[model samples]
Target: MKRIFKFIENNFFVIVILFVAITLLYPNIFSWVLGKVHGINIMNLLLSIILFGMGTTLKFENFTEVFKKPKEIGVGLIAQYMIMPLLALTLAYIFKLDTALTAGLILVGTVPGGTASDVITFLAKGDLALSVSLTAISTVISPLLTPLITVLLIGNHIHFNPIEMFISIVQIVLIPIILGLLVNYKFPDFTENLKDYLPAVSSIVICLIIGGVLGANINSIYTASWIILVVIILQYFIGVALGFVVGYLSGMKMKQITTVAIELGFQNSGLSTSLAKTHFPNYPIATVPGALYSVWQNLAGSILAYLFRKYLNKEE
Candidate 1:
């Protein structure tokens, strides 16, 4: 049982891909499940659960570390907020994507760093503390930054009410995370005991979210699969490259560069998907880029981490 759980934790991206494929090929399965709970904001609920689990993994020390190394964290935050959104907007325009696809790609760009970046940093033998700090800070401020950037970048093309977005982010992300942190602080022992299970829980919820999004947009996905895939792939690699450049030019160490690269490259796509579903229901297809991105970034991040690990090992 333990090994099975471990396997699921380690191979989460694979599991996500399998489920997405299954959902796409047989949308009825998920659509039926979704229909059973019609009128419920399922994505919002799942995102809150995921954010709560993320909060449990965090410690107060993580926030203090941000002040301890403000420069590193600042560089990471700037790179994360700047590079990806610009790259996404540029790519969306260059690709001449329709409004929904353009908004989807840009939405993926505007969100915060994924919690998965911390794990990828550890796997790559990079700066885990820096990764964690970046993720924490970015996520904490996502409610503000995500909406602001989304509005600035694509507001003319899409109907986005930043105020509504702010409210949603607060409700779905900030509140739950704060609750989780409080639980962790108050019951350290209990939280620690359950820590190992959190990843599996998060993985399951994320996969289900992806499945739901894919299932909801199966017909549109069939038509725009290739183009959207290409745009998302470009968005990921460009963010990675620019992250490294920003880190190096800012005088960060190689490991810090690796950490920032991962952070910048991996947006909180689950958040994007959730926000898309909740706020942009009129454009269900807009969630597709984020859903697809959720799968591709993990694969790309893992491969990059492995290569970085091998190269770092050689240097050491």
Candidate 2:
């Protein structure tokens, strides 16, 4: 048993892939949890735990890194905020996706960077500090920016409470992240030593979130498979391209370029899902694109990270 757990710890990505596959295959498990789980708000609780774990991984350096390399972070932030939303809108129109799904896609695009970006950045030999800063700033700014952008871009298609959405952001994202940072500051050694385990726990939580959502809406994805794939790919590519374009235009280095690209390509789908459920309950389907993107982006980012690592080894 100990060996099996250690193996899972060593190959976290493979575990994530297997979890997602199993969840996708047996979505009913998600429903069972939702049905059996009481007022504990299991999903939200798990998400909060994951967010807290994320905070433990952060430090003041993450934020200060922005000042050291403002151009790279700025370009990456612009690409992340711009590319995905535009692509979401365009894809919605082209695919003529269901109104609820269109709004969901837009929400997914509008969301800020996720904790996963930092992991991906590290694995790809990109700029960890820049990714952390970008994720932090984008997230802190989300309450104001995300709601406004969502209202302007997608509110027409779905009803939402910007205020409620903002509140949810505070509860689920900002507050937990702040708490995690405080915990890290208060107990630096523990956080540092426990870093390895955090990844595995985070991976498990992420897979659970995806699984729960997929299980809850398995039929929707099955029915809209092509549209979902198209939107996910479009969001990823546009994000990657825009990140590189902006980084190069700003004269960032190769590593910075890669960091920006990965950061821009992936987003905090968990936040999007929470907002969709809280603010737009009438249109639960609006969370589908974000949920699907969560699964797809991790897979694509893992492949990209592996390829980049191999290429860098050859260059050395």
Winning candidate number (lDDT): 1
Alpha carbon lDDT at 218, candidate 1 = 84
lDDT of 1 by residue, 197-223 (tens): 878877888788788878888889889
Candidate 2 residue-pair clash tally: 1
Q: Model 1, poorest ten-residue lDDT window?
A: 29-38
Give the C-alpha miss distance for residue 34 in model 1, angstroms: 5.6
For candidate 2, the TM-score is 0.91
RMSD of each: 1.7, 2.4
Cα lDDT of candidate 2 equals 0.77
**How does each model score on lDDT?**
0.85, 0.77
Give a tens-digit lDDT track for model 2, residues 1-316.
Answer: 5455466655666766676688777777765433325555566677778788888888878877768877776777677777777878888898888887888788888989888888788888887778889988888788778888888897776777888778777777778889989999999998887676776676777777777777777777788878788878887877877787777788877788888888888898877776676676677677677777887788788888887667742253
Q: Which stretches of candidate 2 lie over 4 Å from their true place?
A: 1-6, 9-13, 32-40, 312-316
